[model samples]
Structures are given as structure tokens and as C-alpha cells.
Target: MERERVNRKIAAIFAADVAGYSRLMGMDEEGTLARLKAHRRELVDPKIVEYYGRIVKTTGDGMLVEFPSVVDAVRCAVEVQRGMVERNAEVPQGTRIEFRVGITVGDIIIEGGDIFGDRVNVAARLEQLAEPGGICVSGRVQEDTQGRLEIAFEDAGERQLKNIARPVRVYRVRPSAAAATARPALTLPEKPSAAVLPFQNMSGDPEQEYFADGMVEEIITALSRFKSLFVIARNSSFTYKGKAVDIKQVGRELGVRYVLEGSVRKAANRVRITGQLIDATTGAHLWADRFDGALEDIFDLQDRVATSVVGAIAPKLEQAEIERSERKPIGNLDAYDCYLRGMASLYQWSKESNDEALRLLYRSIELDPAFVSAYGAAAWCYVWRKTQGWVANSAQDKIEAIRLARRAVELGKDDAAALSAGGITFAHIAGDLDGGAAFIERALVLNPNLAGAWLNSGWVRVWLGEPEVAIEHLARAMRLSPLDPILFRMQGAMASAHLFAGHYDEASAWAEKALRENPNLQQGLRVAAASHALAGRLEEAQKAVARIRQLDPDFRISNMQDRLPAVLRPQDFARYAEGLRKAGLPG
Candidate 1:
């Protein structure tokens, strides 16, 4: 293939960004955004057009411009700053939106309506150095603009900028001094927020539009239940239904951190829902998954799609937040930050990480005593310990776990994450099978879209000795979060449910699937051994038993009941023990 040619030119680059953008958003997000939009519409754009400047692209809080002459660029920057000063005259100094403009005359590469190269980088860095409502220029720009304009230049000495090979002298333009403080601006909600745009009907049938619109509405309603998230109302999200949207623009307009956009394709008896979660501010694709099912189960399909999408993206959003928190200075860490960090550790699925996660979670609770999710997650850490055999029948541990679970349930009556997590803790650690199942069922009622809740309910059903019911719940959970980080947990539960239901072949198959993802999962190994032995796969069963021995040398059939859920039916436990004996496990 012939390579596309490169384009380069010497241009005067103008870069400007809002000062203290984050703080401004935090203070009065809507008002700050409204003012910024008005400023751009009335002052900044007009000045740039008057100066013969070409607008390149705009980030959420910043814009880049190009001019043929450095003098024109400097003039535009000066006029914009002057206009801002006038606009802020009637506004409070603290809430005023201020622009910091940086002009540099340098070579840039242009392609596909975007400019690139080191000059662009320098302009951005220079913009960062400018004071609020002020203008800064490079030596070259200062030289070209000098005496060509009425603006006075203040000599800002040579400064070494990041990633720049050489220190470049800078000059500040003395536009009428405008006072702007590092106060608040329009910011996304502190809690993770999202908007679900209407899904396009790609079936080439106009009548299918309702199905697509209904999908978006259902998703918006379901996502609203995540008390940890701020979801845009259905009406607001539907406004962008058929429009070709810019994700960043949508994010700003809706004030959300993420946007979910997708399309629905239907053919006789079958429909497919495809969705992609995007980081609205940065336009990054965080996650994407598709669900395909029969059209006869239309409502159920919608519910499944909503649950799966929420289940998949919730963790992705949390992971994105964790990454953002990781970038903050250590001293700036807050309770939420600690909670995110703790969750990051908890997901590692190791003893040491679980311990660290518990410590951090408790620290979060200490920082904010009313943090319900922290209590729930801390309780989950205890559940993890027991499941991993790190703790066994410790009455004190069980009491502490129960205490945390109860507090979580009491405080977070409507929080699905808190409820589901607490439910799992109660069931697995405290052996309150009925109460645990009730908590999870309530969570499902509150947020039927929560995959984790479905997963928890499935396991509880298995312990309740309703193997067939457990299988259906587990299958639903899998459909809801096919790519979930804890997918192995769901798979292992399926294996157990199948083994108890006497589908030995299906049980072995699912056990293998679980072990494929988590080779050292003790539960998976035990299930694999039992299923394989019952299915007459003698060699495979013996090998799984050997591996289990390596993981827990003291393991024996006599004490297996301690490892399994205590509520397991007597006959189910006997069958499992018999299978293990057949697999050559010692009594």
C-alpha cells in the first residue's frame, strides 16, 4: 500500500484552557458551563474570526486555534482576555470562568483537520503557565507581535517546560488586569455518572424504532438504581437519540463521566444488542459487549441487556475511577479514594491483597462512618477469606462479618452494591442463608440490572438445595455479565449447581471452564474432581484430586463439609463426598 503523504506548515498556534477547571466544575458545574458557553458564543469566537484565526478542535475545557500570522494570534488572545474581564465585571470573582491563552509560532503537522507535533505540545504547556484571564507568548510570537499591536509585553524570563528540548523565553501580554480566582467550575458529579443515548435501529425496519428507543429507556431506568452513579434522566438522554453526537459534547451537556451508545439489529425471531461504554471526557472506549437472544423473550431480553450492560460497565467505570484516583497526590486521597483503592486490591483475589483490602476498606469507614459500601466491601473481604480457606470457622471473624453486613444493609437499604455485597457476606461467612437470599432478592428488585446480585442469589439458591432454580439464576447471571472480572465465580457456581442436579457431564464442562480462568480455585478443583469422577472421567478426576492436594495438603473428605456451604442438603453433600471418594481423595 502506498503511504499517505505527510503535511507540515509553519503556523501561529493559539491554545487556551480554563483555569482551575476541576474546582470550577466542583463548585457550580451548570452555572460555570453556561457562562463558558455564553462567553464563547459572544466574545471568543467572534474575536477569533475577526483575527482571521481557524478553530481546530476543542477539548472539554480548552480550544486550539491556528493563525497565519503571529500578530493575528496575539491580537485574538488579547481581545478574548479583555472581553472576559468585562464579562466578569458583574460576576463574582470567585465563580468567574477565566481563560489562559498561550501563543507560539512554530511548525506543526496537519492532517484530517487536526494539528500535531512538538509545537502543539509547547503551546499547551505554555497555556498551563499563563495566569487566569491572562495571555502568554513565545519569543518568536512576541517578536512578530511587538509594535504591531497596542498591547504591552511583560518579560517572563526563560523557563524550562516539560518535554521541550530547550528553555524558551516567554512574554506576558498586559491586557486590562482581570481578577479570577481558582474557585469552582462545572464538574461531573462526584459519584460516577453516565448517560444512555438511544440505540439506533439497524434492522432497516422503521417499526423497530420503538424497540430501540425502549431499550434506551429501560437502560436509563435500570442504571438509575445504582445510587453510586448519577444517571441522566430518560428525557434528557433521548434528546440525543437520533443525532450524530460528539461524546465529549454529550458528556458536557449531560454532565456525565461516561456515555453508553449502541445499536439494535433484529431479524425474524432473533435480536442482537451491541453496546460500547466510552469515557466521555477523554473519548476512550472503556468496555464493549454484545447480547444476542430470541425475540420471543423480548422483555426478558431487554432486562438481560440492561443488567449485562450495567454489570459490565460498572466495574469498568470503577476501574477508570481507580486509575484517576491513583494519579492524585497521596495527601489528597479521600474516603472515596481509599474505597477505590481497597476495591482494586480486593479484586486481585489473593490472601495478601484481601487483607490489605480489608484494612483500606476499614480505613475508609473510619474516614466516613456512614460509608455503607465500605462496610459491605469490608464484610466481603471476610467472605473472601473464608472462601479461600484463609479463615475457617472463626467465631470472632464471623461475628465481625455479620456486624458489618448488618450495618451495610441497615444503612444502604437502597444501594444495590451494598445490599448485594452484604448479602454474599451474610450467606457465605455468617451462614444466614435465608436472610442472605432475601437481601439479594431485595437488591434484584431494587436493581434487576445488577449481575452480581444475580450471581449471589444463584449461590444462595444452591445452598438452599434448589439446584434447578440455582442453575437458572446462575445462567442469568452469566448472561448479565459475560465479561465480568468475577466470571469464574459464576462459572464455578454453575458447576456446583449442575453437579448437585446430577448433570455430571455438564458439571465437569463448567468446572473446566472455571478452572481455565482460575487454575488455583479450590472450589473449582473440588467440583471438577467430583464431576469428572461421576462422569466416569477417572484419569481427569484423579489429576484434579492431586492438584487439590497440592493446594491444601490437609484436605480430607471428613472435613469437606466445613469447606462447603453448611446449608447444603444432606443428600447433595453425600453425593459430592461419594464422587470425591471415587476420585481417590482420602477420607
Candidate 2:
């Protein structure tokens, strides 16, 4: 007898088992084993090695492997599936071998050259959950595998497993084409809906990819404010990043009826952004434009791109709105360059990013004090500090935020960003909800492409107890800024509005969808909890409450007034409060 001791480490475990293996073996035992051996030797093993994965054990019909990295595990899984696909092409569909693979990353006990732990068990269970010729992965694997692989994952939610101590979050992974084809085509809701696809970096310079992506994001942010758009989050849209995709396929995968696609090319001293809008169902080009400008005038270029995109989708969008979308700094374009850098920093949403963004934004305003957008960006830094609890004096930050926001509006009343920021600051910090809503609405009318304006307007309406109207505006915002990072805020607003209207099911569904994009979205958790409670789902409501506390331990309705827009109508306030209470929110 020999004894061995080794420390346990967290690793991605990949478990796979052949589907219908018993039937195949029963049909021809020797042939089945021989074919399986040959496949492993010739195709599967090499790909696994190529992806830097190690095989731990092999059952006659299944294999268990350990990957040093999650990226490798995912890549190996995708390649194995792809290779299997090619190998199966020659055989009759019914006679071809298929595999169901499951991946999980967690701590596992290693003993006697065999792996053992709950993690292993979870992977095995997930493998069982996978469809034939498909891959299933634990939530841990999903989080770790993003940005490192070219795979698409559909949420399977929590699943109950036999003998498993707890339910597991699972994601189903399949070939992108197969997944798109598998989705049932559904009619668009009467509501406004849209999808944002990754903008192609036609600049030829790889460094400019981030710039092009950032511009798309800004456009999405502007549209998200409209409150009438069903904007897909950036993460969802960016999944198609660097992939050749069809507009119809994008719509089907994202469940949006309209699609926005474009390319960005930047030369030494000139830049051009070309965009097109298409009806996803018909694949008909609804609108197209090419924006060319000096590199120094990048801000103006972005504004033009946004205006053209908005004008194409909603012909009724007024010229005033287009002008608002085109608003930029009145002084040096250098300041605008700094502003873009500031925006890039802000997108990171970290302490370091915040500091860098604040510094750059201040520099932009210093160079061009008349720059209303810079003021708005500065106000946002205060908002971020306050929200993140990084402010030394919350009251002071609120006052400064309100002042800067108001200044932005005064300086650029025609600018959508200025109006949007001013309205949000007034509603959330100044406690002047009606005034804020009015400003946001004015901004929206001036630029239907202003997603932020629509989103803010929708928030105001929801606070005023007009949920149906809010939903429309939010949907429009979504359409304009389908790839915005903060678009989840609009989704949460929609859910909140639905909850207040006593549309519990719709509220829950939207909230779930929002959380799907951002699991830690506080507003989504609140709305989801309230919706579940209103629908008599006490367990679910409690679970949502638990999640809320996990994210914001000190959260309560009493403090919500300071945190939320104050423009809500009495009825709306009461309804929202009631839902929160029912959802187990503390008074």
C-alpha cells in the first residue's frame, strides 16, 4: 500500500460522455470500441493537446480531462466539437457519434492520480444536462471563459440535479450557426426593439479597435436614455465581435427586430464612420450614411454618426434632435480628444479609472470650458463617486454634481448629453423630479437618437406611475444604443415600471433579463424581488432579497429617496414602495 498527499487547487474540469454509447456498443461492441479508440487517437486527443489540455482518465465511452487554464478548456471543447463535426460529415447523420461535454472551475481533491470532489460531480451532472453534440458549462466556467474564446452561451438558469447538494447555474454552448438556426423565429412585439452589432474596425490599425468600440458604446448610451428602445446590452452585441455575421442572425440570437451595423476607418489626419440600419426580418436596408471628418474633429464625427443612425431608424426624429446629437465642444478639438480618453477611463469603472477619468475630464473642460459635454462627464464622476461610496462628503458631492450638471445644461441647452445629465442630477440629487423629467423630455424631442435622454425620460415617467409610457421610451433608447454598457439600467427601469403597474410577470421577466446581462445590477435585483413578491412567489422574493443584501448590505427604501429620482408621482411612489416592502426590502 502507498500513501500520497497533495494540496487541492482550483482548476477547470472538463467531463464528456458519448450520447447513445450503450446503443452503439450493443449494435457492435468491437466496432464501437475500435471506432472510439481511433477517433480519440486521430482527432480528439491531438486537438486537446493543441489547446493545452491534459487527459486525466478515459472510460470506454467517455473522457475526463483537467485544463491548467479555463481558456484552454473552452478552446479545447470548441475545437473537439468542430473536429467531431468535420469527422461526422462523411457518415450518415444517424450513424455518427456525438458527445455531450460539461466544464466547471472549482476546487477539487486530487488523490491517487484520480480527481475527486463536488466540482467533479457538478461537471458530470452538467455533462448529463448537455444536449447531443453540444457543450454545457457551470456558471464559474462561463465567467472565466469570456473574452478568451469565440463561443456563445445561452442561459439555462438554475437546474435541479439528482444527489447534488445545490442547484447549479448552467449555460448551453453550441455552434453559433446551429444555435441561431435552432431558435424559433418570433414576431416582434408592438414595442420598439433593436440590436447593436460590433462595429468593424476598418481603420487597419489594430489599436483603433477600442476607439471604434467606444464610439459605438457612446451612441448606445445616448439612445438608452430614450425610454422607448429595447436596447441589447453591449456584452450581448460584442459577442459577435470579430465574427462575420448576418443581420437576421444577430436579430434572432438577440431577440431584436431591428439591427444596426457599421464600420470605422481612421487615417493619419482623417476619419470616416459608415453605418447602416436594417430590418432584421426582411434584411432590407432602411438607412445608410457615411461620415467623413478631420481626425481633430472626432467629437463632431461621433455626433454625426449618431445623428445619421437615429435619423435612419426613426424618420420622424426632429432636426433639432439631430442638431443636439451633433453638439460638441466649441473650442479646441484637443480638449475633445482628452474627453474621449476620459470616457475610455470611465468605462473601466474602477477607482483608478475614476481618478484618471476625472483628471482627463477636468483637463478637457480646462482647455474648452464652454464644452458642455465635458461638464456632464465631470458631473458623472461625482455621481460615480457618490454611488460607489468613495465620496468623503456625500452632501458636498451632490451639491457639486447638481451645480456642474446645471452648468452643463445652461452652457449647452441644445446638447442632448448636457440635458440628460442635468435632468438625472436634478431628479436624483436635487429632488426636483418634475423639472428633471421636463429637461430629459426636451432633450429627447431634440434628438431621438439620444438614448440617455429617452432612458431618463422613461425613468421619470415610471416614477410618475405611467409604466406603459415609460416602457415605450425605454424601448426606443434600447434601439438607439443597443450596445451600450449601461443599457441594463434601462432594462431595470422597464422592470420597475412594470412592477409599479402591477404587471408582475412582465416585471419579473424583464428583471431576469437585465440580471442576465449584469448579475450584480442592483435595480434589477430590486425589481425582480418586488415582482416575485407581488406575484406571490415568496421563496423567489426572499432569494432576490438575499442577493440584494449581498450586493448592498445597507440598502433600504428609506435611503432610496436620496438614491432614486424624486420626480415620482404619489401613486407611483406608493406602488413602488409597496412592491419593495413585499419583496422584503427594509423600510
Candidate 3:
């Protein structure tokens, strides 16, 4: 038998590499080579020596170093990145060099000055995962350097490093230059990006821990259905379940603009769920609320929490995105940029804006044919045309609207916006009420947090002759998004629901609310006129009728049958026509 000898020593390994080094070198080999050498000589070499790290080896685009202390390794990485930022200021944007660094602490086999084994590989893998001009470190390195350094570390969750045997917990080092340069700002997705952190289980009962985790996962799933949102996956967010985290750090680590954090307290048959939305860049609390409900309704609470967070953040996100687009230099906007501009136009709800919205959405689809959101929104523009009586050619426009709607549904079967918008278009423009309602129901199943789906469900119920159910669904929509941009739409739905149920005063009240938000909204005026007439407020009813006539002068009670396929439900047409006739509409 031969004696086996193994040499091992715990060491902190640091790996640094230039992001897109191959591309840079390919673009200008001579210039890139000269710059790399100069960087190592002027900035890199001095920092390594000052931190007391030994140079193990150097590749053309990367290097490996051994540090005796994790703190020193992190400090050296930070200083180098800051120096790179300053150096990059003198270069063209296209030729900028950004280095990514990774650090890890583990037992390694040191043959001479060079190191080998899993420890070294892990460091390299971490480097590859790091963002350009950023640092990534293993959980051990973060733990050791926690109190020893002045820098902050953001939890990046568990990462499955390529070829590594075990998963490594990762954190991002917040460099001082993060504030000095826009390079460190989160690269926001074309749409809003958000993360729902694991809920804090304040119940003190370990058994209910599962409940809290489930709540966050449900929220993530619900948010995922929104075509307008880029939601962080559940696996990544749950990594911070038991950790004390900084919201801005989470935002940077996740590369999202908003963060939703909450706590769950369960005791016996009751539970309390509290949530708050934060703007990661400014550390501002965008929204906050709490829900108290029965334990059996825990699932509903989860859905509500998800809905509330999205509803609260969506308008803010949209306004911010719109402002961003408005400020962008002209002629280089991509598909998403056009889409955001279209959204801003559509929300204005004027005839000129409606045309502009349609044009921009069409341009967006032309830019990226696979953009599901643009198609859905484009189809929705036609729905607006029909509702507002702005159609230049009903026959031709209907054909085009149907084509766009069908395409949206096919491309975005899993997206709540597509499903809901396509369904409503089919229901309103194509008069396939049943088929459209089925799609809306599927959208709700895909994402119960979708406030629009709930509101649409209410309208679908009314069209199907289920007025009470319509009211109930609308109430749910309101609770989920008390501050939604579509609140006026929900109010109009509620008004229609009450009107069909013969609750004249209630209908009038809701219609009034809708009109207050959107005085020109056709549905609001129709419902208000009908409800006031049915309640014997003849003067008010006549005033509403006059206002509606200004928007749709050809309006007549008899035309309701052709205009509203929803009137097919039993006596629904008669009910609507009777009220309209009494309100002074032509019969």
C-alpha cells in the first residue's frame, strides 16, 4: 500500500474578469490589449499589493489572486471597481472596460503559489455570474467580512454555479461608485419589474412558517400573469426568508424598481397580513396596507395582497415609465418604448390620443411581432372605438379588431392583459359574450390578482344576466385596487350591475362617481340617465340623456339590440331599452 498525501489550507480566493472581454478585444485588439496592460500596471497591481494578496495566475482577460483575509479581498475588489469607473470616464462609451470580481473562502490545495480544487472553481463561477463592474461573494466570505468592513452586502439569493457540486449563497457588494455613476442603477425592464419578498411570520408559531412562505409564492405566481410586469421568480425571492434585508439592496440585487415586503400573523382561526411597497431607488414607501381575515380565507388574503401591491405600484410605475419615455431622445425608441408611449396616450382617452395610441401600438408590434402586450392594447383601442362610437367603418374596423384580438389571445395565453383585453374585445365588438367570458375566467384563474379581470368579470356577469354576481365581482375588484387607474371603469360596471338589478338610486350613485372621474365616458352617462329615469328623477335623467347624445347623437333605444350583444340575455334588451326610452332616448 502507498501512503497518500494531501495538502490543504483555508484561503480566500479572488477572481476578476473583464465583462465582454472577447467582444472588446475583437473590436480593437491592439487598443484593448494596451488598455488592459495599463490598467493592471496602474490600478490593479497596486491594489493587490496593498491588500497583501498573492497573484496566483493571470489570463489575458482575467486573473486569480489569493487573499489571507476575506475583508482585505473585498476591500481590494471595491477599490479596483471604483478606480475602473474613474478610468472609464476618459474613454468612449463603446470602449468602456468593466471588470466583474468574485470572492470565496474555502479549503484549497496550494501547489506552490497557484491554487486548485472546487474552491478556486467556485470563485471563477461567481465571477462569471457577477454583473459588469460589480462584485459577487459566497456566503462564507460575506459572513466573515460582515462587521470587518464598512461596505454593504446585498443578498443575491442561492445561485447554482455551473459545474459546482453544491449551491452557493451569493451577495452583491454595493460599491461606493454605485451612486456616483448611473452604471450601478438597476437596469429596469421595459415593463415594471417587482419582487415580493418572503413574508415575515410574526405568529411566533414555527408551524405557521409554511403559511407565510406560501403567501409570498402565491403573490409571485399571481404577479407573473401580468404581461406588463417582470416578476422575480419564487425560488430567488424565498432565499431571504429568514434574513434581515435592506429594501434598496434587494432592489439592486434583483434588478427591480419596486419591492413588496410583508408580514403574516396567524393565530387560531384568524390571520393578519400586512404589506408595503417600496421604491428601491428612493427608499420611498409607495403603498402599505393590512388585511384581517378568517384562517380559511387565507388563500383569498394571499390573492388580495398580491392584487393590492400590483394595483398600488402599477400606476406609479406607468407614470414613471411614461415620463422616462417622454424624456428619451427621439428616433431610437424600441418596441417597449413605443408601447409605453402608447399607454400614456391611451390613458388620456381623447379621440386624437386614441388614434395616436393605435398608431404607436401598431408600430410597436411592427418592431417586435412577438410583443403580446402591444397586440392586446391595440385590440383594446378598437374596443374603445366601439364604446365611444368613434368607429369610421364598423364593418372594416370590426374585422381588423377581431384579427388583432385573436392574435393577442394566441400569443399571450398565459398573460392576464392579453386574455382580459382580448376577451373584452370579443365580447363588446364581436358579440361572442360566452366565449369572451370564458377567456376572462381563465385569465382570473391564471392570475386572480388581476384587478382588471375582476372588474371585467363583473361586466361579463351582467351581460350573462347575473347582475348580483356582477356586483360581487366588482366589489372584489375595488378591494384589490382601491386606487387603480381603472377605478372609473369599475364604477361604471357597478352602476350597470345595479341598474340591471333595478336598484335605481344605487345605480345612479355609482354612475355619478364614474362620471366624476371621467365625465365623457359613454357608459357612465348611459347608466346615469337610465337609473335617474327609473328612479323618477326626470330632470336629471334628461340632462344625462342630452350629455350622452352629444357623444353619440345617433343613439336610440331600438339600436341597443344591435349595439349590445349582451342584450341577448332574456329580457335584458327590453330592460335597457325601457329605461333609455323613459330617459328621452329615441325609440
Candidate 4:
């Protein structure tokens, strides 16, 4: 049998489809078809032509395109994505149409007005890998377009593509222009930016509207003081005060990374304030918290609520940026990126991650020698190691920690994050309780809304043997940042405060809550065991002790005080040791 010679040619194959097309049609068939047609006619088809792409064919929800070069294909895809973003800005999210695009450079079999080949199959598979409103490309395409385009590529790593003979390394394109177009009305500042929209009045009295507006204005003013943040002015933010507006549109108009929208309710002599922080670019809710206080001092309550909201979302914004930095390719790491990545590693709370965090923080410092937050964060890493009983060379670690903390404090006299981090490190690692407390108090004065400062103050008070004050500080931190990633740590500190206050049952309950969040938290486990034992829950205490043994086999009651903060008073340490002994900890 003789095989007919197949006509073939090398080309850049482009594949695209509307994500969730069937669902959109199911929801609104006529409207979906009309919008899809309008998009193709106005945006997609024009972009394809402008980029010198030949549209091979079109299905109801997708189309196949061929280009002379990979550059043309990628450029066209990015334009389409950007155009879709702009067009859908006004459209409701549920009904918005987003496209997934993929491109590859390979040989293709050509027929009369049609095409078929493995390259075509690869392009379709790559499209499936792309996120909605995103583009993915084969490694070959990425190599060809290197330095030829202004787009950034995130290495998605090798993926075992469906039904493909071999694995394909995919790269997700992150177009810088897409971000620019996302906020066409304004350019975002380099620093983390946010806007505080006027809180809605849910108190059923129009008179309460002033209270909500006043709360937002105070928040805006307090947030403006953070040197690290770029806050939208009150005048600009209040433009949407009385109107129903989309968060994404607000983000675009204001050119900010985060949007805070909340509500206020007043009843009798008591008032409640609820706030939520959202990532403007992606519309993801990052943090939310509520504050309740008496209306005896309305202005004072407003000030407290404002400070609380800022305290909560600042870390969340940083966390969101860290996650964003992680998504970028390793080659794209700047000084801030390195710092963010280091913070991410630090939060993992493992020995290995802690080491990596230190290395990355040092790298960040090497890149920017005067980065105060990096120095402060690095100092805290050593403090974390001391708490975990992971310090191998105590003298060397203490010297390095002190050096870093002092540098942070000296350089960042007005930086709250740096001051708080450095101050806590001093208290925990150097036993400079008074010095650390002074620095943290200064941080609070500088940025009263900083949650980290409040948290650090809580621990400082614990070491100072002010258990009641510690509880209050920790409670403030919790209410300010309820969704904080380190919430378990806060809860554990609360348990310790309760334990030292002779509230054994409260200590046990708080420790159990911390354990629920992180079963392997050694501090939480120890607190749980001690509190349960002291509260006469012998069975629960035994269970916690067993888990503590599992986590750290060398745990002993005699050496337990060494694992605790250095500044704990003799009486508090005695109480903790007695509870551990009752819990049957090793002698």
C-alpha cells in the first residue's frame, strides 16, 4: 500500500476558547451568543488581523489561528486578553466572558482550508492549561519569544499533558501591559496601595451615616502614615460614597491594589464595625474583622475602629504581595520580592524553611542594604529559632539577632513593622525586656493601627508578668486581624497569659483552639498539656504530652524553661513548670 504524501508546513499554531462557555450559554443563551458574536466581530477578529494571523475556523465558543511567527501569536493573544479585561470591567463577573489562549511553534499538516497535526493537538492541550483570561505557551514558543517581547513568563514547569506522547514544559505569559490596561485610568504606585470606601450605614438611621464616613476618613488618614503604603486620598475614595459600585471598577479608577469596604451598625449605646479587605486586581477577599465597643465615647470608638482596620489589612496586603511575587519566575525577584519570599518561608515555621528565609532575607539585604523591614524580619527569624529550640550556637545566634535588630531599629525609627519585629526579637532573644517594650511602644505611637505592634506588645507584657495587660493586647491583635496567618501563635500566647493568670480552664480552651489550627505547634501542644493538667483534665493532658513527644522527642520538663521566652519571671516559670510536671513531662 502506498501512502499519499501529506502536505505539511511549519507554523505557529494558536488555539483559544471561551472558558465556561457552556455554563454561560446555559445561564443566558441569547445574551451569551450576542456578546460572544460582538466580541469576535469587534475585538478578536480585528486583533487577529492586525497581528497578521490567519483564522482557520471558528466553533461556537472558540477559534483556531495560525501565524507566521510565535511573536505575532503571543502579541495577538496578549492584546485579546487585555481587550477582554477592559470590555468585561463593566460586566458582572458571573456573565463576563474570558478566554484561555495557547501557542506553539511546530510542524503542521495542512489540508484545503483546514489543519491537523500533533502541534495542533499540543496547542489545544496548552489552552486547557491556561487560566481564564490567561495565556500559556510551549517551551519552544517561550524560547523563540525571549527578549523579543516585553511580556513576563512564569515557569509552570513540565506538565504531563493529556494523551500527549511526551511531557511539555508550559510557560504562563504575564503581560505587563495587561496590568497597565487593568487600571487604564491611573497608574499604581510602586508601594502597596489601598483605598478605604465609606462604610455603609446599616443602623437604619441616616444620622449614623456620618459615623461610618468619619470612620473611613480616620482609616484613610491613619493608613496614610505608613511609609510603606500608598493610600488613596479621602476625596477620591468618597466619590463612590453613595452609589453602588463594582470593586474592580473602583480599583481601576483609583489605581490601588486593595479595596476596603465595610459597614457600621449602632444600637442604643453600643456600636459594631465590620470591615473586609479585598484584592482589587483579582477581587479575592484577603482579611475581614469586626469591632464592637460602647458608644460612650463615639469619637474614641471611631479612632479605635479606624486603627483596628488598618492594623488588620496591612499584613494581609503584604501577604498578598508575597504570594504575587511567588507566582513570578525566580529570575524576576527584586529586593522586595526576595523579602516577600523570605517572609513566605518564615511563615511556614519549619527549621528548613526558617533557614531558607534567613538566606533569602540576607539576599534581600545584600540587594538593598538599608531595607529596614528585611533586617527586622531577619532578626525575628532568629527569635523563632530560639522558640523552636533549633538554635545550635546560642551565643553566635544571639549576637547576630541583636545586630540585625539594632540595625533595624536604628534605620527604621519611624517604621512600625521594623520597630515591632526588632523589638519583639530583642525581648525574646536578648532578654532586653525594657528596651524591647520601649521600642514596641514607640511603634504603637508611630502607627497605632499596626496589628504586629499590638501582638508584640502582648508578648512583652507576658514576659513582664502583666498577664491581664497581655490578654488585652493579644485580644486587640486578634480582633484587628482575625484572618492573620499567625493567628495560632496569637491564640497560643493567649493560653500562656491565661495560664499565668491562674485561669487554668481558659488556658486549656485557648491552647486547644491554637492546636486545632496547627496540630504540630510545639508551643500550643505544651500549653495544652500544661493547662489541661492544671485544670484536672488528666486524659487530655496526657494526649497533648504524647503529641509533644511525637513532635520533639527530647522534650523534658527540666529543659522546658529554656524553650520559653527568656524574660519570663521566676513565679510565672514556676507555675508553668509545675503544670508540666503534673502533665507527666519527662524529668
Q: Estimate each model's TM-score.
A: 0.48, 0.55, 0.47, 0.48
Return the TM-score for candidate 3, rounded to 2 decimals.
Answer: 0.47
Cα lDDT of candidate 2 equals: 0.77
In angstroms, the error of model 3 at 111 is: 75
Worst 10 residues of 4 by lDDT: 324-333
What would the per-residue lDDT of candidate 3 be over residues 377-411, giving only the tens digit for each residue?
Answer: 89989888777778788889889988998998998
For residues 1-587, could you state the per-residue lDDT of candidate 4 as single tens digits? Answer: 99999999999999999999999999999999999999998889988997899999988798899999889899889878877887898698889999999899899999999999999999999999999999999999999998787688999999998888999999999955645464343434566778888889999997556566656755665565565666665555776778897897788677687899999898987888888888886699988877888765444555555455555556555543322212111122256567767876786888999999999999988988888878998999998888777888888999999999999999898777789989998898889999999999999877655667888999999889898999999976764444455788889899999999999999989998988888878888888888898889889988998888887888897787568888989998888888888888989
True-structure lDDT of candidate 3: 0.81
N/CA/C clash count, model 2: 34
Q: Write the per-residue lDDT of candidate 2 for residues 1-587, one digit (tens) a residue.
A: 68766669878899998999999888878877887888788778887887778788998788899888888888788767766775676577666788889999999888767898898889999999988888999888889876566567899999987788899999997556555454433334445567667789998888777678866876665554444455665556776888888788677556677788898888889888888889996699988888888877776777776666666666676666556555444558677678878987887766679889989988988898888888987887776665444566777877888888889889867776788878877776677887888888778765565667778788777777678898998887775555556766778888888888789999999999888877877678878987898799988988998998887787788876554554656676677677779888898
lDDT sort, best first: 4, 3, 1, 2
Q: lDDT of model 4 at residue 381?
A: 92
Q: Between 2 and 4, whose TM-score is larger? A: 2
C-alpha RMSD values across all candidates: 23.7, 17.9, 24.1, 21.1
- What ranges in model 1 sit over 4 Å off? 1-333
* Stretches > 4 Å off in candidate 3: 1-333, 561-570
Best by lDDT: 4
Number of colliding residue pairs in each model:
8, 34, 0, 0
Scored against the true structure, residue 285 in model 3 reaches a CA lDDT of: 96
Q: Highest TM-score: which candidate?
A: 2
Clashing pairs in 4: none
